[model samples]
Target: MAYYISSFISPFGMILINILDGGEEPALKLTTEVLTGHVAVYHGDQIWRVEANPDWSLGETAQALSDLAFEAEIPEELRTLGIAALQNCVSDLYRRQPFVTA
Candidate 1:
């Protein structure tokens, strides 16, 4: 069971972030749709796996994109997308914690 957090179109493709099985961290999945052959994945705040399609995973490109986000070096137009995705994921996880109070 994965909880979808956010998604956005980028140079790479349609990037989506989700929490896998109620996990605390987010998993990033890159998809190019029917237009191209790009695909990748991001997990554990790192590049968990990446490879060519139809195999699913996040590679170096996705890692670089996230790195730029963390370093605040992503282009102005794309800035905040990744950061917001991460923030949203964490916020949702925190809210789900048993000890959390209203």
Candidate 2:
């Protein structure tokens, strides 16, 4: 199962974000309503979107997005959106993880 999060726009188009929950196989059905057990990104309007496996860490997703942020395929005008999404997810993980800073 998974949770539908927010979506971000890129030069290519909208990049939908989904948070995977429980251990259920994805159905790949698209909808505007947020639900569980799926990580489907509606790409009817755009060709690219960041997606994570059921076992992948959001940190990994953030890293993947970070890496994609610099790809030649990504337009300069919208590069920051992907990077910002990655940073936002990373920042959320940072605050959620247990850590001690000096």
How would you encode candidate 2's per-residue C-alpha lDDT over 5-50 as one tens digit per residue?
A: 3444222212344332232522121221223322233222343344
Worst lDDT run of 10 residues, candidate 1, spans: 48-57
Query: Scored by Cα lDDT, where does model 2 land?
Result: 0.38
CA RMSD for every model?
Answer: 13.7, 12.2
* lDDT top scorer: 1
Error of 2 at 22 (Å): 35
Against the hidden true structure, what lDDT does model 1 obtain?
Answer: 0.42
Give the per-residue lDDT digits (tens) of candidate 1, residues 10-37.
3322355543335565544322333444
Displacement of residue 40 (Cα, Å) in model 1 is 11
What TM value does model 1 have?
0.31
Off by over 4 Å in 2: 1-44, 49-51, 96-102
- As a TM-score, model 2 comes out at 0.40
